[model samples]
Target: MQTYNAPLRDMRFVLHELHGLDALTSLPYFADLNAETVDLVLEEASRIATEVLLPLNASGDAEGCIVENGVVRTPKGFREAYDVFRDGGWNALAGDPDYGGQGLPESVNKLVEEMICAANLSFGLYPGLTHGAVMALSAYGSSELKDLYLPKMIDGIWSGAMCLTESQCGTDLGLLRTRAVPQEDGSYLLTGSKIFISAGEHDLTENIIHLVLARLPDAPPGIKGISLFLAPKFLPKPDGSVGPRNGILCTGLEHKMGLKASATCQISFDDAQAWLVGAPHKGMQSMFVMMNEERLGVGIQGLGVASAAYQSAVSYAKDRLQGRSLSGTKRPDLAADPIIVHPDVRRMLMTMRTTAEGCRAVGIWVAQAVDLSKHANTEGERKEAADFVALMTPVVKALFTDLGFEAASLGVQVYGGHGYIREHGVEQYVRDARIAMLYEGTNGIQALDLVGRKMPAHMGRYLRRLFHPISNFIEAHRKHEAVAGMVEQLERAFGALQLATGQIAQAGLKDPEEAGAAATDYLRLLGLVAMGYMFVRSAVIASERLAGNTDEPEFYRAKLASARFFIDRTLPQATALFLAIKSGKASMMALEEAAF
Candidate 1:
């Protein structure tokens, strides 16, 4: 079995080189964070990931989680690991300082998340969901709610869950049947069932706070009538101690395809005592705060697992002896050369490497944009940052996961029969990454949102956020001799994305179905362009670093190589996707309802 190791060097390269640390440090809130401080934080986080979490991954997978007598019990060693995690202040890495948090920049914490996911994704879910829950509560929860729940949840004495999907509803929250009846004491009685709730029940925390979406008794039908509520598993007493158990119960634990150790529960709330987080009938507005961040978190999850699988594949290729190289006998003393020497094997390796690295850059860049959106000094800077984030969030969520699953499957392919076997662990990456695309509004829904909502948002303001950066970068570097070929390739791909975006937007106005038909491919096309842009940015940085005779020449050289692979191979797919987006909805909508 290949044990997980945090790719600290690559993480540093992405953070400090491609997306500068100064971006975060420039903010007044992040004034204390410099390269050295960030490096120390990452190093310590890497230590925990490699040492504490990695050792328990396979064990947890094998043991899974057990639900008995209404309480969920996580796999062996999970409780202890989480204790260490919480005590290490890992839970509050990017939390608010007012509530006993570290108050770090989100971009810094994003790398920590990637490391956790790569090391042990099942274990990471507990804190991952908690972080989202805290975001919602901090943004919209009443002062009382925040004073009571935020401190414990942020400190990890209590965990949290987002309860939105019910039995009859997934993406369509309008059809939900959950009801929150108003109480005489100013709270509500939440009576509903939320299905597929991650981290819904666990023994790792003293209490569990649930951010549920439900409807008021007097509410009109559909989404507008829906409201958000904060319900706890154990109600707190007047002294702030754990009191009586609330009405919420983990009725059952889901038998999943992957992340077996992460408890996904079917929660039943029979008149659960709850408090409203925001204004009545404004639940969706509050929930979007969590949803958007969770979307980015899901993308990071995909990147993490794919990175693990890629590392596993690379490690195996270097060690596994196979037939002689097609070119010649590279290892003359041995009967067979390693599979890595084969051209075909190298191609697969390059695909995994380029995709994983390119996606990392893209994900981190978005993370930086998120920090700026929240903390930038001026309104112009903040809105510009927000626009970029809105445009790329769907692309990151959909494309990163789509490519992640592909990369995981490629790992299985690279390992051949050994990959399918459980002990090797590459297959687990595939299984775990499979669900990211389905949850968090599904990749299909994300594509629809990108085409229908985000592109047309503020009369094309969001789309322009993406377009301007690439256009500016291209114009500035068009004459640079070192990267001329790469720039030319990126320019063509950027044009493809522009054409696809315009055609989809125009087609959507005439018939919404046209946008739906083109959405998935269009999102992928947009993702490729984003990846190209990141590659170009990285290449330019690497080119400058190499010119300075940096201490790490090989590192910069490998970055340039990855960029070349992305431009030459990956960027070409944009043309095909652009053509597909322009193909119209005729073939798609031609069939009748029963034509299948």
Candidate 2:
């Protein structure tokens, strides 16, 4: 069976040692937080993950969710588990304090989110969508709406879902046909059918608040006419009690390859009453806030699954004795040696380890920027942090998920035939991990956003936020004795990234197709370089700790080893990606339309 124990030690290393807690506490918003408090929080979260959530993962997948008589029921025990989760205030860990949240920084909350996702991704979806809704309402909703919905949502009494996709429209909102008519009392009556809505209808909460996108009666055609509306499963009375049911129903539940415990619903809205969120025709702007946050959350989901898969793979590797090691029979007392002793097995294990750890580090780095973007004292500092967050969003979303799926697949390979069957539970990781690459603005779209929009935004101001820091880091550490080799690799990769950036900028301006063709490769190149940067920095920190005679020598040594593997085995992929980008859209777009 698959088992997940939160990597709390590494999380601590990332939070305290790599990205200093001091820097976070320096911000006024996180001023009250200390290392001790953070450690306690992490320990408790780990307890919940192991005790409450992890046990439900396999069973939940087996049972899935069911919808009968327009009511959706999550897997057995999920409601109780959710109550435990919500009562503990896990849902509002990083929400606004004014809305009864703990107001924790994203830096800490993201690590907690990773733990939740790792333990049970389907269960995590319940609160995950709610958190995204809370963010959107907080950012764009009017005072009355926020007052009415934010508290209950943030407190976990209610859950939320994003309603944007339709049968004909997945990526192109311009094709959406959902319509909203203004009511006399200033509310809007919405009528639409939405598909693939995760956590859209579930019995876990008292009410499900849906942020729907529809066009006003007099709205323009295409994407420009789209508007965001807040439609709840049950309307709230004046005193915040659940009122009459709205004109929304879950018509059907999607049967999927994975995340079965999460209700992916076919929702029918028949003249549902909704309030406008932001201005008319500017729905994307408000929804993007939630989408961007969810994108990051999805990236963390990838990391979470990868981490769980790696742990399960490692456990199986150490326990499953296949054949004698190539070197010799290390376990002579047994029939054969554990597979971990074999070089090929080691390769797969190391790949999974390095990918998960590297993504975790990069996630934390971006998460710190998220904190700074909101809590920084100076406007310039906040703007710089925001730019960094914006530039790294797609990278985090695409890179983490792509590599996460790779790691999960590798886990299955490590488990051999046993991995393919449901008995071992590793196959579930493969199925669950696949979806992360497709949702929250598919990785392809993420790459295009990185290349087409963000790459050229404000004459490449966003690029500066990333490139300058990495450039300075490489230059400063080029001659450092402890990590000189890794620094050298990072510098070379960064050079390739720089060249690719310039090429895309110049070539894309002349021919957009060139940029379109190179988008995916270019995004990978940048992501690899960013991860390489993190590994090099981690090595430096590990070296310092080892030199100082730290007690946790094995942990530091493992960090150094993972860093070396990333630099030696993984970072070199930058060369191939760069070559692919340099090749441009010629051979890619060369084939005739009828060739396929």
Candidate 3:
């Protein structure tokens, strides 16, 4: 009757089979996250996703966010759903325990993130911002600020917002014109206009904590002049009670094509009382504290939307008996066999499955990398993990989202005419997936950052660290007959990254355009190869699990099948990218200045 929701089977496979969930608890920080606990947590999350959130998704799209007299209203059932969500401790599931969070490992949190987003992406945005807000404060806020805000935020009584954009600047912070002035009371007066602020202002919580970015009067030109501030919707009194409204107010809302239920705000502050978040002129660093986390979260959004579309399409294909089977269906009693019996239908479903499952594995690995980076005892170990995050963050954001949109489009194609209609909700997925690529630094900027900044960070330390695990995977799996083709493709792509790096290092020294031209597509290639390795890993896990005693045989088998589909069907694209990256910028740069 209802549409299928949340890829729980694949998620569990990634958690237990592809990775050693039971063994990870030996690490002190993760000692509490045993396999049983993980199962319990994920199972409950699945229920909420199917019951509470999924029902509200379409209505949220139809209603969108509403703004009146500086107060914002979420679509029909969002507040109630968010209240249930917060009461269930879902917002703080991946947060710091000292601030009232569950303090689970990033591995545990990502599963919850996937389910919630797949259910109602807009409903999740409210807490999603809160999670980032709490993370920012936990990482950089002073004791007074943390003491005053994180509890209420953690409790879901308050939400968090980050204001960093202006009319002239989206990704280029150097061009922003917002201003903040210091006061004698150890606070700053922030006056600026910020656009596209997600969860910028909402009624889901009693108060909203805004981490605002503005340039001070003495601030230097461009981004170096900027500063970060902790400005809340309601100024906190000495006793931590909400006071009268602060100067910060929502001026308007963006009427976007999708995720309409999640309020995107245009807020203007006329000398709002704001406190410095981190060191002066280090505002970009603090906001990035949230942005990097949000970037990964946006990638999760991509995965989430893809899963939603894919699940619905799978169900639709099975039930819509519009076509005959290639093998000739035996359903003589029916007018036609299920569309899924057709090869074309299988291709669509398999495409969605492989992309979604592969992305899930990559996201899980990246999340673990972040957790280890935070909790690892040694500086060198921490650096290794941080470097992985650095190299992968942009790739995760750009490539995953790109694939996400593509998957969404393919999902619509699966449903044919019914998918294009508003009632089926496939088009909403396409609309939702589109923004992920645009926000939190466009894919173009992500590519440039990869080539210009990430590739060369710390004199190649990031790339070196990134290649370690990838190289290990290739070396270990190089001989496997089933996935050797996949590994060979990955090796070529990995080698291309190395080759491109050397070329960029040489070319960047002479001219920057060569590096820029190679970036975006290079990131895609890198992402594809990285995911190809994940597919190989999944195949290993599935093969190993199926060999041993297992209660969930079918689940494990499908995972292996999906991994094979990914490797055999998807990984070869890296060959095209490998050829292109090796060719290197000559054709791209050959165009004359006036040719356009």
How much does candidate 2 score in TM-score? 0.99
Residues 1-596 of candidate 2 have per-residue lDDT tens digits of: 78789999999999998889888799888889999999999999999999999999999999999999899999999999999999999998999999999988898999999999999999988898999999999999999999999999999999999999999999898899999999889999999899999999999999999999999988999999999999999999999999999999999999899998999999999999999999999999999999999999999999999999999999999999888988778998999899999998899999999988999999999999999998899999999999999999999999999999999999999999999999899999999999999988999999999998999999999999989989999889989999998998899899899999888888999999999999999999998998898899999999999999799999999999999998999999999998999998899988999997
Write down the TM-score of every candidate.
0.99, 0.99, 0.96
Report the error of model 1 at residue 590, Å: 2.1
Q: Each candidate: what lDDT?
A: 0.91, 0.93, 0.83
Model 2: worst 10 consecutive residues (lDDT sum): 21-30
lDDT of 2: 0.93
Question: Residue-pair clashes per candidate, as listed?
Answer: 0, 0, 0
Q: Of models 1 and 3, which has the larger lDDT? A: 1
List per-candidate RMSD values in Å.
Answer: 1.0, 0.8, 1.8
Local accuracy of candidate 1 as per-residue lDDT tens digits, 368-459: 99999989999999999999999999999999899889989999889999999999988888899899989889999999999889989999
User: Cα miss at 519, model 3 (Å)?
Assistant: 1.0
* Among all candidates shown, the one with the greatest lDDT: 2
Candidate 1's TM-score:
0.99
Position 291, candidate 2: lDDT: 97
Q: Quickly count the clashes in candidate 1.
A: 0
